[model samples]
Structures are given as structure tokens and as C-alpha cells.
Target: MEAAHGTSHFLRDGVVMLGFALGFVLLFRRLGLGATLGYLVAGVVIGPQVLGLIGDAESMIGFAELGIVLLLFIVGLELAPARLWAMKREILGLGLVQVALCGIALTAAIGLATNFSWAAAVALGMPLALSSTAQVLPMLQSAGRLKTPFGERAFSILLFQDLSIIAMITVVAALSRNPADAGGPPGWQLALMTLAAIAGLIIAGRFLVRPLFRLIGGLGEREMFIVAALFTIAACAGTMELLGLSTALGAFLAGVMLADTPYRHELETDVEPFRSILLGLFFLAVGMMLDLQAIADRPVFVAVAAIGLIAIKASVIGGIAMIIGMGWRNALALGLLLSQGGEFGFVMFAQAQAGLLISPEAASLFGAVVTLSMASTPFLMMLTAPLRRAAQSTEQREEPNNDGAGALVIGYGRFGQTVAQMLMLSDIRVTLIDIDTEMIDVAGTFGSKVYFGDGTRIDLLRQAGAADAEALLFCLDGAQLDAGVLGAVREAFPRPKIFVRAFDRRTLIDLRDAPHDFAVREVMESAVTMARAALEMLGENLQDIDAAEQEYRRNDDERLDAQRAAGDYGAAREMVISHQTELAARARLRIPGRPTNRTGAGR
Candidate 1:
């Protein structure tokens, strides 16, 4: 009875936490404050300091730290080894310089600001040099700028910060005044262990993890992939824990090993939800653990420290970015975006407490500082919106040249090439536009001039002579077009005939409401040809194969028409599945002297 009662209590806590989180997140998000702050506020409200609804914020935090580890893993998956190497300059230059400068600068500031010695200040301050990865990354992703150069640079610095966590730990351990830390290995030993662990994890990833994923993939078990992805993170993180190293780094390394693998997208899809929930939980726990009494006692100190931290980091980072040749506006935006003290600050502060570098009260004070700094970011961004927009407008992207061309091909990939060549065969003047710079360079070498710019952008299309061109063929790969884009294009320049290359059947169905002269399924023709060849290889007559092909095409068209009008596949599913038997019956009826099975046919 007691065990059942405990389970109910546990369920109650879960319900309260999630419900409060949802409500607060919705409110904060509606207010344009972002969900991180909402989660933090909810945590505080539900915590012991307020309503006392939740239990053991510290233990909740320990479990929630997995969110950080998973987030690093996903970030690592975005950077393949080759890409990481390509970013060596920014990682080492901007990242390393920014971290070193901020650490030293903050250390001095903290040392002078409070009663702590130089060592304690260093321990507390180094963590503040790191910004909230959990906050910044989601913002970049939501803005669809994660693949942009600015985002890449921001991520490079964050990646380096994650890598530097071990070094920070070592610095803290080396400066320890506690008896417990006295028995730990020296900094040099820790460094060697980190190197060995990294090497082993990489080897295991190639030998063990990839093979494990391959086996699960061949079995076609998506559930197993989820299991495998989580297991990989746990295994790496657990290994790092055993070695007294950073588990987040371990998970990150695991992700990096599989970064270039075919399963990267699948792994990201599987692990992202867990990362999000845990990350939110992490922020909540951080909030819950924030000492309200401590903040109330010295609100001025907390406010000043938080503001100073933001100011110092932003100035230092912005200066470095400008020195590295970024425009002042972009530099300022980047700095403000990363000004908040990171989630890892809590971990470092805990380390400081364990090392006897700072008291729990001091740690809580700095934690509050970090939290306050974080809360200021959305406001900072909102204030800088105009500057960022102006900077983006002047960014150096190749513009399309106006040529009195009859046809403009948007993509220069395999699909676009065929379309362009076919059009040129008719002696029509074709203007080629492609977003891929490398492909354009290669095409130039082959004496083909393809302009570089986003073809989907309405302004770019207009500049590329979309109005004057006889045909505007969207041959870009994937489902880049939607009803919104198609509608805009149609409304903007209705004179040119529009053709779209759909990635699949779903793409075609999705844009059925949009106005377009024609939609070409990227693979439909080739697939039909392959099916015809297969039939021939199976000893089926060409005449019968043609009939079969014609029947399938007719049925497909009927299904598409039905699906388009109904806005669902339910009404069209039977048209596809039931067509086989009908086709066979029709074929038999066409045979000479075949018996008619249909009603009133034999008469």
C-alpha cells in the first residue's frame, strides 16, 4: 500500500511539473521571452522556495544534466570531421581567443568585485565565459540560419567551449583547496586520460556503434534505432563518468564519429525529442535550485554581476569578431546573442564548492547571476532586430544577371541539367540560376554559366527575369516549393508559365492547391521505365507490359485527382490497391475467346 502511494505521489509530481512548464512556456512564448525563461520561472514557482510542490531539485538536476549531454551529441552530429577541419581557423581563432580573453577578464572582475581570492574567482568566472548553448542553438535553428556562415561561426565557438570544459575542470581541480580533490590525479594525468578516452570512443564508434546501427537498420526496426541512439549516448557518457571526465564531451565525440554516416539524419530524428525535454527540465531544475533568499539578500550584487557579465562578454566577443573582419552590426549581434552565462556554469560552480574554492552561498549567488543574464537575451535580441536585418540585406551573395532568355532553370543538379539541355536543343535562350557555388564554378569550367542565388526567393526570381522569361522551371531538388511560395510566385508574376519538380508523390499532393502549369515527379518516369524493364526480364510480353503501364498510370491519375479534391489519401487508397485485380480482369477480357465473367457480358 505504501509503495502504491509512493507511485501516485511520483505521478502527481510529474503532472505538476509538466503542467506548470506547459502553462509558463505558453505564456512566456506568447510574450516573446522564449521557453527557456518560462521553464526557469515555472521551476522557481513550483520549487521549495515558493509553493514547495516538487521534491529534491538537486537530484532532479543530476538526471536533467543528460539533456546537456544529448544536446552536445546532436550538435556534434552537425559537424563532420571534414567540416570541423575546414572550420579550424574560426574554432581556433575566434573561439579560443574569445574563451581565453573572457575567462581572464571575468576572473579579474570577480576577484576584485567580491571577497574571494584569485583562485575562487577563476573557478567561478571561467564558466561564465561559456554562453548558454541550449538557448542560442534553438534560436539559430528556428531562424533557419544554422547552415548560414554566421551560424557556423557561432557554433564553432560553442563547440570549442564544449571542448574546453575538460580544461576548465582541470583548472578547477588544479586550484582545489579541498581534501577530497587532493587525492585526484594531476592536470597532466587528466589530459592524458582525456586523450586516451577520446581515441577509444572514436575506435568504438567506427567498430562497434556503426555496426550496431547497421544491424538495426537492416532489420528495419525504427524503435531499435531509438534504443541504439540513446544507448550510444549513455555508453559514451557513462564511460566519461567512470574516467572522471566530461560525459557531454563523450556523447559529443560519439556523435562526431557518426556525423558523416548515412544514419546521421535518422539518429538526429530519434534523439531530438529526448534532448528537448531533458534540456527544458535542466533549465527548470536550474531555476528551482536558484536560492531566492540569496537573491533577495543581495539583489544589487546579483543584478550588477549579471549585467557586468553580459556587458564584458559581449564587448570582448564583439571586438574579436570585428577584428576578424565581420561588420560591426553582425559582430554586435553575435556578441549579444551569446552574452548569457551557460548551463555548464552550474556544474562548474558545483565543482568549485566541491573543491572548497567557494562556499555554497557564493555558488548560488553566481548561479542567480547566470540565470538573470540568460533572461536578458530575448530582450537584447528584440532591441537589435533592425541592425541584424540591415546587416543581412547587405550580405555578399551573387546576384542573377538579366539576359533576354526564354527559359530560366533554377537548379543545375541532375534534373535541372536535363531540362536546360532539352530547352537549349530547341535553340531557345536559357538563363541558368543555381544556389550551389561549387556547382556553378564547375559549370563555368565546362563553359556553362549558371548564376548563383536562392531561386526560391521572390525578389531573386524577379531579378533573374522571371517576368520576361517564357518559362520559370523550378528544378531544385527536394520539396523546396510549398503552397505559400507557389502562391506568392503566381501572384507576383502571372505572365510566365511555372513548372515545378516535385521530390515525391507527397510533394505533388501538397501543392495541388497551388497554381502551376505542370508538376514533374522527379523519379516517376525513371521508376516506370525500371518497372517496364523488370516485367520484360520476367518474360512478360512488351504489349502486355505497355497495357499494364497504361493501366497503372490511369489509376494513379484517378487517385491523385481524388486525393487532391478530398485533401486526404483515404479516398484514393482503394483506387491503387484495388486496381491490380481490375487490371488482370481487363487483360483476360482482351484475350481472344476469353470467357466474360462480368454481368450481361456472355449474352
Candidate 2:
């Protein structure tokens, strides 16, 4: 009866939590506020201080930490050894500098503001120095800037922070003083334990994990594969915890080792749902942990501390970015994006509380401040958008525009260069327009005349001879920019034949619906070439491969046209599958001696 009651309670709590989380996230998403903020809001509403939905914040936190563990593991899987090695300079140099500077600065400020021992203040500073990888990376990805310079730099710093968590955990363990036992393991013993755990994880990952996974994969059971993956994460995390090391560290090491494996993408797909759910729970737990009473009592202090923390961190990060030679816009964006205390701060604070390193009153207040800072990050990013744009504008204004040619090509980057090269080879007297001055200068060095200006602007387009231009070609840097240029050109000129370069299938679909005569996908030709080469390597005749390629293109075009006409991607995808099945059937019926060449006549 007791066991049954416990099970029932668990189910009820799970349902309540899920229901609240979904509602909050959906509403917040509808308002364009983001799901992270929504999760935090949900936690606050359902917390003990408000509705008293969950009585045990600590229990929820423990479960939510699994989300972070899995998150770091996924992060590790994305970073192959070669990629990590390539960013070593930024990770160590810029990352360490940011941490040290922030820690020292924050330590001094906290020491002056409150009455706390230097050790405690320093411990607090450590967590505060770290930025939210969970928050920043996704935001950058959603904005389609993860491949941009700023995003890369921000990622480098975040990677360094994740690695530095091991050191931070070690420090916290060393500071730990058990109330029941005065003579616990010494600092050196703790350090040895940490080192031994790390070594054990490495050895196990290198020797044990890959072969085990391969064995499981050979069974060809997806359920078993998922089970094995989970077991790996749990075993690694548990082993590290037993060794008095960070569980996240162990999971991360395991992920890094498995990064180069063939099963990496499969592992990611299997683990993503659990990670996302748990991560949301973790954020919700953070919200619940907020000390509402303390905030009410000292609202002014709480507000000021949150604002001050953001200001200090942003300044430090921005300064470091500039010192590391980042452009003003990128530096500022990096700063704003990283100006919040990370989820790890809560973990460290909890550990400190358990170790009796910090007083309950101080911990409560600090936790509230951290939560407030995190909650305010999305708003801060929104505020900094205009400044980033202004910085870009200032940088663009400094570039010189010399002369115009007969044909003006927008965007002189990789795609634009290819178009320009092809046109110039034909002696078409092509002129290039680009926002990036560096690219313009590089083109000039290569004896190609280029103009620096925003192609989306009508005035700039006219200055570059849009009125008398033979044709308009867009190979813009991003999808958003391409769409903007397409809209402007269509509205202003309407007569010139417009050609666009699409980076992906989605972009191709979007452009198909636009007023453009020609939409060439950047990767199609290369992909087809590679496919044809593979076929030739497999002993297929070159003529048959060419015929196959032509048929594939024709079918793809018909499928895309049907998809656009129906306005349903699902149906279009099904049509593609059905078409492919028919092709396979036809290939199977072909005579053994003679080759079959079936072609769709429509262009």
C-alpha cells in the first residue's frame, strides 16, 4: 500500500510538471520570448513560494542535473578531437583570460559589497565567471549565426568554461569540510582522486566504449542501441560521482571519445529528447529555487545586484573580445550573449551549502541574484540588437567604392566569386558588390573589380547601375539577406531577370515561390558529381550514371513543383519516396545484358 501510494504521487507530480512546462513554453514561444524563459517562468509559478505544487526543490534539482550531464555529453560529441585542437588557442587563451579576469573582478566586488570570508567570495566568483552554454549556443543557432565569427569565438570561450568545470569542482571539493568528520581526506588525496577518475574515464573510453558500442550495433536492434547509450552515460556519471569528481566531466569525456565514431549522429538522435526535457526541468528547478521572500524583503538590493552582475560580466567579456582582435559588433554581441550566470552556478552554490562553506542566508540571496540575472538575459540580448547593427553600419561606411561595371554581382564571397569568375571568363565585364570590405579587397588583388555597398538598398543598387544592369545575381551571405534583396529587387525594378544561389533544399523551395527566373542550389552540382563518381567506382557505366543523374534531377524538379502547387511538404516528401520506389522497380526489371535509360521529358 505504501509503495502504491508512492508510485501514484510520482505520477501525479510528473503530470503536473509536464503540463505546466508545456503550457508555459508554448505561450512564451507564441509571444516570441523563447522556451528557456518560459521554463524559468513555469518553475517560478509552480514553486513552493507560489502555488506549492512541488514540496521538494532539491529532489527536482537532482533529476534536472541529468539534463545538464546529457547536454555536455552532446556538446562533447559535436566536438571531434581535431576540431577541439584547432580551437585550442581561443579556448585556452581567450577563455582562461575571461575567467580569471571575471573571477578576480567579481571577487573584489563581492568582498566589498558583503561581509564574507575571502575564500567564500572567491568560490562564489568562480561560478559567476562561467557563462550559459545552454542558453547562448541555441540562441545563436536559431539566429543562424553559429558559423559567424562572433559565434565561433563565443563557442570557444564556452568550451573552455565546460572544461574548466573540472578544476572548479576540484576546488570546491578541496574546500569541503564535513561537519561530522574533522579529519577527512586531505587536499592532495582529493586531487589524486580527481586525477585517477579522469585517467580511468580516458582509459575506459579509449579501450572499452567503442568495442562495446560496435558489439551492440552489430546486433542491429535500435532499442538495444539506445539502452546501451543510456547505460554508458549512467555508468560514466555514477563512476565519476563515486570518485568525488564531476559527473558532467566524465560524461563529457565519454562523448568526446565517441565523437569520431560512426554512431555519433545516432547517439545524438537517441539522446536529444531526454536531454531537452531534462534541461527544461533543470531550468524550471532554477526558477523554483528563487527566494521570493528574500527578494520581497530586499527588492532594491536584488534588482541592483542582478543588473550589476550583468554589467560587470558584459564589460569583462567585451573587453576580452576586443583584446583578442574581434570586431566591435561581434565583440559586443559576444559580451551581451554571455552576460548571465550559468546553470552550473546553482550546482556550485548547492555544493557550497552542503559543505557548509557559505551561510544559508548568503546562499539564498546569491541564488536569487543568479536566477534574476539568468531571467534577464533574453531581454538584454534584445536590447543589444540595435547596437550590433549600428556597429556593422559604422564598419561598412568606412569602405571605399571606386567604380561600376556593366554587370553588378551582389555578395563577393565564395558563391558570388564563382558566379563572377564564370561571367568574367566569358568577357561579360562583371562588377561585384559586397558588404564585406575584406572580400572586396581580396577580389581587387585577384584583378576583379568590386564595389562595397549593401545590395539590398535601392539607392546603392542604383549607384551600381541597377537600372541599366543586364541582369541581377544574388549569392548573398545568408538566407535572410537573400530574401531581403529579393523583395527589394522585385518591388523596385520588376523587369530584370533575377538569379539566386540557394545554399540548401529549403532555400531552394523558398526561392521557387519567389519572383526569380533561375535558382541554382550551391551544392547540387558537386553532390551529383560525387554521386556519379561513386557509381563509376562501383563498376557502373558512365553513360548510365549520367542518365540516372538526369532522371533524378527531372523527378526532383517535378516533385518540387508538385509540392509548391499543393503547399504541403509532407505530401511532396511522400511523392519523392514513391518516385524513388518506382525507379528502383524499373531498375530491377531491366534486362541483364542491356542497360535501360528512362528519362522524364519535362525540363
Best by TM-score: 1
Root-mean-square deviation per candidate: 11.1, 14.4
- TM-score of each candidate structure, all chains considered together: 0.70, 0.66
- Quickly count the clashes in candidate 2: 0
TM-score result, candidate 1 = 0.70
Which segments of model 2 are wrong by more than 4 Å?
Answer: 181-183, 391-603
**Model 1, range 160-278, lDDT digits (tens) per residue?**
89878868977876676777656788766777888899999999999998778766665656687789899999999899989977787788888888886656656776678899999
Where does candidate 1 stray beyond 4 Å?
A: 143-148, 397-603
Model 2 steric clash pairs: none
- Top candidate on lDDT is 1
Cα deviation at 500, candidate 1, in Å, is 12
What does candidate 2's lDDT look like per residue over 433-461, in tens digits? 76554555566677765654456667567
